[model samples]
Target chain A: MKAPAIDKKVLYAYLEEIKDPEIPVLSIIDLGIVRDVVMNEEGELDVTITATYTGCPAMDMIAAAIRVEMHTLGFKKVNIRYAISPAWTTEWMSKEGKRKLKEYGIAAPDKRFSIPADGVECPRCNSVNTRLISEFGSTACKALYQCNDCMEPFDYFKCH
Target chain B: MSESLINYTLHLADNALILGQRNSEWCGHGPVLEQDIAITNISLDLIGQARSLYQYAAEKMNAAAGKEHPAVTEDTLAYYRTEREFKNCLLTEQPRGDWAQTVLRQFFFSTYQYYLYQQLQQYADTNLAAIAEKSLKEVSYHLRWSSEWVIRLGDGTDESNRRMKEAVNELWRYTGELFVPAPYEKELGIDPGSMQADWMKKVSAVFEEATLQVPEKIFMQTGGKTGVHSEHLGYILTELQYVQRTYPGCEW
Candidate 1:
């Protein structure tokens, strides 16, 4: 017996509904962790993902979430694979992702790979008057920043 | 599974694992809140690298099983291994003295790793190469962060300068083992000896900027690469492996 095939577009829609465990405001699709999703010849869904950094603890949670979602959607045998070659960079974060992060109180990473000399624009008051409190923030993928105007501390999605 | 390959892989894993553990000690005790988080983040990166390398080594160990070989997992490789079986460099196993000592040790090791990983990326082993490539980015960040700190501390206050200089002198001896090419490292195309000149050059440049003097003594320490480690490693393993040893097969 053969199982019906899943439309790739529909698959992404389901995956897009799954937000990042850390930054719940942004979905995996927006975070650029989901590299590829395709149906194998055996009717199994193969989902490829990349970790944000070398030892991100969120990777396991993301994998588990994907498996659960697939199973709930009747994907009896979904294969989740990790791709590490072309390492995930902040450049992969979508425009929508950046907006959502800002809306949720985190500054987005710039396109540049190096740390900015001044500081990322503060997410709280949208103030340019900010200083980097630390190169690393509450998480590995973020840096701590403080806005001089509003005097609010926030995390900035770091440029990997 | 090639025994030499497994050993070589463990060498890399042990260094990352032990160093990560040392850094993790500063989790909430960093000099400042932000730097505390920063060091811990770097610790996470190193620990993650260790896990990947250990997983690969465990796969190799299990694949070459005979009647005498036991089942291997990341946990087993990390916790079950005796102190005599660890192959990390001595520098990584040293006690994290003060902030200066910690940063200087990290600077030394990160500089070595930055060059080492660059070469390892081109090694014949694809998995090892991938791991190297992945780790290089994080290690580069570590190198940059620690380098800036070295210069800041060295050129900062008089007390800081004295402490930084003392740290440099004390930690310089442990650096020799990094460049000594072990038998397996050589076979795997890891020419550690060749990296020494570049490592020294990079260190010297940083030292020059920091306005600190590099120790004139060329005498070096060795032995960690071959599983013989300092007294510090035993204490580290005691705490690191405590949960695993106390409750075998423990999991969250």
Candidate 2:
């Protein structure tokens, strides 16, 4: 016999507790990497997720954190799956997540398809007059930018 | 199992691996902080692409019944393989000579990858297509970054222009290998030759804008795709595989 049906909402709540290793304020749910959660007939808890970047080192860490969180939630058979088809886009990042990211002093990605060209508002001084220092920042997903208004450099979440 | 497909996958993985390795040499050695981070970030992306391709190749190799290591993995493929067994193109294995050379090399490879991924994303092979599609996004940035640098350096001060010219002369011969389809690539129905025109058009336009001359007398070098490599690959493998060979399967 299969285990009792668990609420998908409850599973989401558990998942929301797991934060991104690099970006602490955003959880996997906020990042939109958690694609689906399924309770199979065999009572396995399968979480389908996508990587922000195929080679993002955080994927393995995030997957491990998911396993630990699920275990704490009492999931005995946890299967973490990866999907790469439609590809993960910054568009999937949540509105609340964006706000949090901005508050954390990093410019959050503005939603839209194509590659991220500049026009990132300074998360500090809230100025549109920012120049890019480098297209690569501290992490793979971020790029370094400096605000002419604030004269302070910060990271911009690239539109990939 | 389709051996040719597996080899093609390995070739793709190896190209990314070797190029990533070369780029990573600039991790702490860059002229400026931003440039250092930029090259390192590109290295991360390429290495990440390599990991996905290697995993796909490992799975294909293991699917057969008579495999020596039934549990072969990406790690084994990357760290255990000898130099002659690597199937990366010669251009990727070339030494990262100087800042100008690195920029030019990245420009050439990223330009090739941008077009290559565009083609591969439309190909019949789904997994390869998916990886290509995903990589296309990152490769676009790489192309932009490298292209901008190529122009900046080539069109910059007199010293910068001279260095860029030297880089172009030193590196031009190795690029031909990218268009030369290997035996495995031919078997897998991927034509490297088909993308040559597009690649050159983009390169020539960039060179024009950079005020640099495209090589007129191109004596194209070949090999590396078929496993024959420059001496550089041996040194690279020695550095990369040192820990793994010394203590097999050692993990952090």
- Candidates in order, TM-scores: namely 0.95, 0.97
* Best of the candidates, DockQ: 2
For A110-134, candidate 1 gives per-residue lDDT tens digits of: 7652664455788888888888777
Per-residue lDDT, model 2, residue B141, is 86
Locate the minimum summed-lDDT window of 10 residues in model 2 chain B. Answer: B61-70
Model 2 chain A: worst 10 consecutive residues (lDDT sum): A110-119
- Candidate 2: regions farther than 4 A off: A111-118, B66-69
**Over the stretch A1-160, how does candidate 2's per-residue lDDT look in tens digits?**
8688888998898899999999999999999999999988778899999989877999999999999988887788899988888788898999999999999998988754135555578999899888878888899899888888889899989888
Model 1 lDDT on a 0 to 1 scale: 0.89
lDDT of each residue in B152-193, candidate 2, tens digit only: 999999999999999999999999999988888887778999
- Put down candidate 1 lDDT per residue, B109-198, tens digits, no spaces: 999999999998988888899989988988988998999999999999999999999998889999988989888877766679998999
Name the TM-score of chain A in model 1: 0.94
